[model samples]
Target: MPSDSDLVTVPARARTSTTTRVAKVLGLLVLAGLVISFPSLAPDSFILSVGVVIASYAVLATSWNFVGGFTGYISLGHAAYSGLGGYGTALLITRADVNPWLAMVAAGVLVAAFAVPVGIASLRVRGASFVIVSIALVLILLLVFQSWGSFTGGSNGIRLPRPFGDDVLRPEQHERFFYLHAALLAVLLLCWWAIDRSRFGMGLKAIREDEDKAQSLGVPTFTYKLVVFVISAFFTALGGGMYALWFGFLDPIFQFSILVGSYMVLMSLLGGIRSLFGPLLGAVIVGYAMEFFKAQYGDTQAHLIAMGALLAIVVLFMPDGIIPALRGLVNRFRPQAASIREVSAAELAEQRRAAEDTGGSERGEKEEVRR
Candidate 1:
């Protein structure tokens, strides 16, 4: 008895709700399996190392998503905060002999301590100017790290003892680190996903679309930026700690290089910047590609050349990345898929419209007879 519009719209919400529920159940099962298997079984060395690297990168990339992707701030200075985080906690855990776990806490606090001051100063500059200033800060910090030869080991770089015992770790240690990386990644993703769907994420999106409009709407623009900056730096620091742990060393080039910054950007861009899976895809693709190139070409430089080529191809052909590329291809190749959705909606709307029109005519006839 409803209008076509009403019937169609009613079903739209119901269909969406059903689809979301089904997706959630399947996603949960996959996540549970990934988490549960790590403790029970052992992964090969190559697999374990690769997993740690990808998982760690995912954390960094996802953190970057908060401000970079969602808020429209393309940050090339992510390395500055991450390196500071590594050095901050690395110093505490190494020199002060704090627990590595506690060191990670110190890293966050320290990164945030610096982030607040820097963010306050940097937020004064908008858009391109702000980005430039942030990058300059990274260079300045890197110089500072280099200058403090006693603490940071200057150009030579400082080292951190692995959280593992003094004895050379057995195969089990690699698996444990793999699980740790996985666990860390899962926790970070869960947090990011929640934020991405929350009121905060909505506010951030508004700010990204139009900061002036968002600010006019009583969104605390400065506060949100500061909070996102600190939170992003926090996770980046955690990932930095993981990086240091994985390699058992930290070098200035590794920590502060433009390449590291580029890697973060590349991962986000290649994966599908806005989606949750985007960073993961970018990391997996880029990571595996490097290994593949290294094996095939027998030179590290091959990665750079291959990456540049791949990036060019992706930018030219699939700038939206693999996910969007695949979706577009599916829609193009099988027009019926999207047509099916539109058809269903249109059909329901048409049926409801007809029902309403018929009911109206009946009412009119009945009224005339009564009269």
Candidate 2:
């Protein structure tokens, strides 16, 4: 006969496996439904445009997570690559007459090329120094673009021709852009999910947890960080290019702003940086909140104040971010419930055995007295 311990352990393992599978299937189904229905269900162009904005930010946040969340290298200068991508795509399309799609790809490639040297240089530093390097890079790019009036349109910024041209109605244009952004976000998420489960991702996490320990264990920490950094830059730039095409304008000030960089970091942190879907969740919350605040409060400081409050709340209450905190809560209760059931069963078993022993002892005493 199987021991009680074996019986309990086997069922627990089976239940956990079944639960995981069911959860994954349900999650995939929900995601599929959203992807297929969002555009059709959206009420108007305004909603679609907001969706596009959310998706764009999602892509940015997720891409940023490639390096920042996974590798624990909080880069404050990712805007440099994003801005370059915007300008690169804009220039290629406007000056060279390339297709917007091709221009987007080229822009990503260009950003990745640029990231090689930057990653090599920046990855040498740690923590605060790395952050400073990132900020400096973005600042330099902002200054260069702002000053170069002839080439990049300087303070005037550059106007971009819409990908679908002026013939498309505003509503349709927004709908198309919304889908495009969704596709980009989907791709980013898929890549993140893949990497999150990969050996390479394990190395990145190792670096995130302890770089020195990772290196001692033969993980090429520097190489891994730099590679992830370049990959992050590539996707970030693609998102920037898409934004440029969508908005039909690009401004150096807005593109390379510290605020944009901060938003990427904040979104990732607010959602749960360690999880694959953290950035997407964060983007939805932060993106919608920003839009709502701006629409309601106009150009006042109210939005900023609200954002600050939100940040403070997240930091104070959910230090590990919403998803992780919620997960932790769920895990805590789940185990307790299981333990309660097991304890009750064990208690019943003990009571039965004790009762039998007591009854037998009494009977034996009665028999002895009779004898």
Candidate 3:
């Protein structure tokens, strides 16, 4: 019943797919090895430190994507959760004498719990209204943290003990933290990848495409958004707590700044939020650029201007992000027949007409032969 060519093609396609998968796995393994050994490969401690910063940014950006990328809700005040995490971890370590690691975990949990009520209220709005609500949340936290100086150290900020302690050399500390941050990023990436393939992810994408339609289709849009919001807060807070431990300082002004949230949004947008590695790739590029600008310009606010320009360029040109843009370019040039999905309605109509003409011609020829 099957055509001979199709039978041959099926096995060939399967083999090709298997080969491609193996190649991908091998490539990833090599990349992971390189990442793990980056500290040793780096020429100096500064490079290692930069790696830590990039890794932290990747974590934060990926965490942000859990909500921003999935639900299509742009939160401009996500730094509030991160700020809470930083303060919570620092306060626990300094005031309660808790272990730094335990404090970080606790901070994340607390932040996730705090996100529930916030998400309930914030998720009620959409578009600019949601964005405004998010920004207000951050501003409110900023004011509260700044004013409550008696407890939070006020404008002076609080000093956190380095989790690795003074016994560890600076380079070693950087190396250790780099690995810690990288490990967290890997876990988050795996979670994201898993979610991307699940029904839950499909629901999130549906909501992203059309919330009202998603709700009408029996998807619980609010619950899905809320769950993702809390999950995002947890990871984001962990990133903040880790930074607090590594940097040995917690300034509410810096922690709760809207700029931090903006960076997360920008990085995700630059890298292509829908793809698994988009944020990570964006983080590396943006983080490196920021550091390079700061190093070149010193204490001047030149890096902010540079980043703003970069963000503007990304939004204007690569709106879907770099990965998707690159993918489109690749597909455009690839020598392959277009899939049915890619075929235009006009093309499909033309194809149907051609097929019908061919069938009619064959039938006419058969009739002529019978005559």
Superposed on all Cα atoms, model 3 deviates from the true structure by an RMSD in Å of 7.7
Residue pairs clashing in model 2 are none
Q: Which digits, one per residue and each the tens of the lDDT, describe model 3 over residues 245-319?
A: 888898888999999999998999999989888899899999998888888889687877887898899889887
Q: Highest lDDT among the candidates is held by which one?
A: 3
Q: lDDT tens digits, residues 1-371, model 1?
A: 44534433344556866986998789778866975674455346666666666667777777777677677777888888778778877788888999987897778778878788878887755688668866897788788888889878898998888788868564666677767777777787788789889888888878788999999999888788778877887888877876777677788877986667667777888887777777877887887776667668886676777777876777687666777776567557543533546567776666577657765686678789989
TM-score of each: 0.81, 0.86, 0.88
Tell how far residue 303 is off in model 2, in angstroms.
2.4
Question: How many clashes in each candidate?
Answer: 2, 0, 1
Cα lDDT for residue 53, candidate 3: 90
Candidate 2 residue 310 Cα shift, in angstroms, is 2.8
Q: List the residue pairs that clash in candidate 3.
A: 149-154
1-371: candidate 2 lDDT, tens digit per residue: 33334333234456888998999789978976896688889998898888889988998999999998889888878888888999999999988999999999999999999999988887887788789889999999999999999999998999999889678998888788888888888899889889999999999999999988999999988889989999999999999999999988998999999878878988998998998889889999999999988888898988777777887787688757889988878877665643546456765566556656665676678789989
Worst 10 residues of 1 by lDDT: 1-10
lDDT of 2: 0.86
lDDT of each: 0.75, 0.86, 0.87
Ranking of models by lDDT: 3, 2, 1
> In candidate 3, how many Å is residue 102 off?
0.6
The Cα error of candidate 2 at residue 40, in Å, is 1.9
